[model samples]
Target chain A: MNVIVEAGANYVGVIGAGEGATGEQMVQARRVGELLARKGVRVVTGGLGGVMRAACEGAVGAGGVTLGLLPGSDRADGNQFLTVSVPTGLGEMRNALVVRSSEAIIAVGGSWGTLSEIALAVRTGVPVIALGGWPLPGVEVLVAQSPEEAVEAAVRTLAR
Target chain B: MNVIVEAGANYVGVIGAGEGATGEQMVQARRVGELLARKGVRVVTGGLGGVMRAACEGAVGAGGVTLGLLPGSDRADGNQFLTVSVPTGLGEMRNALVVRSSEAIIAVGGSWGTLSEIALAVRTGVPVIALGGWPLPGVEVLVAQSPEEAVEAAVRTLAR
Candidate 1:
């Protein structure tokens, strides 16, 4: 019998909405997660609702492993799609942790909290791929018109 | 002339999608920004696309200052709503920077990327608020069913 060694999966950070799901943002976030799953990449996000949930659902649906980085201390805070939920006691400061844990960041539609996460991501030198918003200051701007293009750009960037 | 001290706003880090707006995710993200703006909080995020853009828009719309953290070296990566743009060439590593810069984290939903962020957040002991995802270990769990509730939880947690 030959023993095979399994390598650790590459992690990607996702940030976005957590309200009632219903609109273009939700669709795009889900599609992006699916595309990333199709590419055989593990997905990471702030397990909540809206875009985060959509992405988790998409990734899990695609037979991919989805990790949920929680904000609270309980597992109930996480969505059902998450394979593993890591609880971070950090409250508002968790933004830094999110940025630090990922090799790259794929930003979707977001708000104030999301903006702060993006800032930290840029400061840490993570490659951020944007789909329909403004580009980062000194990083490569992978602006995609569609979810497919956004994920494609992220994959291509990761490949490099 | 009486000099009134203007309270320095908390440097909030934002994270989210980057596609065109209109969805549950987008709405949630926007609400986060709105809440922050109403409180005169400084918002930060990846200055592009879906959630980031929406958050920035919401913050600016509410008379709040928004910052964009770009992943590339170009200003084009930043969203128009950002009052300031910080350019970072770190690529995906920028995610780490974002997490490091913040005092806490507010997770909207769950995604692979978000999960990674949450991991970093928890690992760093940054207080995190989960609106629709998993909670971090040993941290306060604030499962906000609405945007107002989430923001309140985040603010209250950070205050401690």
Candidate 2:
């Protein structure tokens, strides 16, 4: 229960397919992370492979803070780009941690795990912008056409 | 990372709506908890009101172990029926903890939070039995007609 409140630090989650992600999706996720990091927003992710690794790489490359909520207990399982990696050991349940830790979420692609994070964020009243994500029938999500649009929407949603 | 491996202890999560749970759902959830407890299985819940409280109450009444993963950092926020309440401080994210901690899941009813847990469990290869829950189109969940059926399914799933 150690609550560390960093003043003026905005954590935005970038959720997407972990394995089997398309190259296009990875490119979009990387750009999204870079944009958010350049804006001084901390990028948070599930802390594994595919989109999560790509986003963290982009953020770290831009000299920005990146937090990874890793699924396993081993910190070595996290990508090299993560500035701070929390080995939650909660398996895929760490997706919920990623959603809870972020002020807003930018969904880069679609997957069952990513869908669960989006569902948790929506249920908990966290604003989410999806870029090339699933077409949730009843879910209320703002669909962004590109990575830049997704980052802009996330920033604007947090401002509100 | 303190991992307490309780040998021979089977933990089953009973998830449902907290605030707007119907009386029927409460009765079913309570029966599910009681049945699981009678079999020497531990009942895990979200540690709040409605179905979570009802299930914990039943399990405690049966002199069984009941664990609650509370959403906030205050242990006092948990219901009195919980034998061990861990204040996760992860908001709705605690649903994932409940899912990860359980060997099987018996969903008494459905909500956005419950759905998130169900999705996480299914994604992580955990068995799920839905009793009076949602009919997810593409989701492969075993449906039970009553609490007894749900508890039986949970036990059988764990045995496998």
Candidate 3:
């Protein structure tokens, strides 16, 4: 069997709670996605709700491509802001795909799932700029106390 | 080009925040990993820190085969709990590998990254059981109001 490895970067994945849409966390997520969008970056997410919705909303509001990586094969469930939806049918395993599709990850305030994505990022050595959580191990671990700082760190890191 | 799809429950991908040394979310994540472990599930993650670490701890505690998918090509950065580590030099894209290799996903509670994973799950048509978050649309959104419920939903969904 022959295996082919192909890589492409069209999006930056954002991980966070689907809840708490009206808090500082939500504000931070939107700002990050917006900054990336204003720079012509496409924002990708799990697509259906919460932070995904906020980021997508921000990216689309800024005239950027908002791609939603959905978990199932159905398209009806996707958030309205998604420009494109890639259905993986892998359930939570699809989290891997979200992180894989991005050149880097910007984690906002998150719970356990965000932690896993960061773990995935750290394990993979992807430059994850954490905005509001405990710092990741070893990598740049840009402890940005503000959204602007997080976006700045990501821009700098991706530039490298 | 022909695409060959592999079948069967070869591994169980566990998604967590990596901060779950102690907490309800961590407890729930551990419970889910343990359940899968008891069922002979081969667990996989980013292979370092937080919920990833906790899940590995749970799986190992239950005597399951744990695979840590690292972002870098180096083995030194991998989690100490992993029995096997797959190092992908693709950096954060390693998240895609973790998702692609698994048959299912269980989101314990999340933040930005977890939301992205959930979006991926919804887009991909993967059956994701959210332990904590808003209700997902289209797919079977098993809102596990508790840890046991989350684990049960994840297992039941995977069985289907």
Measured against the true structure, the TM-scores of the candidates, in listed sequence, are: 0.49, 0.81, 0.52
Q: Distance (Å) between predicted and true CA of A104, model 2?
A: 0.7
Q: State which candidate, 1 or 3, has the greater lDDT.
A: 3
Error of 1 at A57 (Å): 0.3
Query: Residue A9, candidate 3: how far off, in angstroms?
Result: 6.4
Q: Stretches of candidate 3 above 4 Å error?
A: A1-10, A134-140, B1-160
Ranking by TM-score: 2, 3, 1
Candidate closest to the true structure, highest DockQ: 2
Candidate order (DockQ): 2, 3, 1
Weakest lDDT window of 10 consecutive positions for candidate 1 chain A = A132-141
Interface RMSD of each: 11.8, 2.1, 9.0
In the range B38-118, model 3's lDDT, one tens digit per residue, is 877777787877778778888889887788988789988888878889877756556656666566677766644454555
RMSD in order of candidates: 14.1, 5.5, 11.0
lDDT (tens digit, per residue) of candidate 1 on B1-160? 5222245557566665455344776788788888888887777776777777877888888888877767788988787898888888755445555667656666666443454455555545666666664443333435668778877766775542
Q: Model 2 chain A — which ten-residue stretch has the worst lDDT?
A: A1-10
Q: List the lowest-lDDT window of 10 residues for candidate 2 chain B.
A: B1-10
Expressed as tens digits, the lDDT of each residue in A72-116 for candidate 3 is 889888989988898777666666677777777888875556666
Clashes of each: 139, 0, 57
lDDT of each: 0.69, 0.87, 0.70
Off by over 4 Å in 2: A1-9, A38-40, A59-65, A73-75, A83-93, A135-137, B1-9, B60-65, B73-76, B87-93
Q: Compose the digit string of candidate 1's lDDT tens values, residues A87-145.
A: 77655455566667777888787454665576556645677776654333334445668
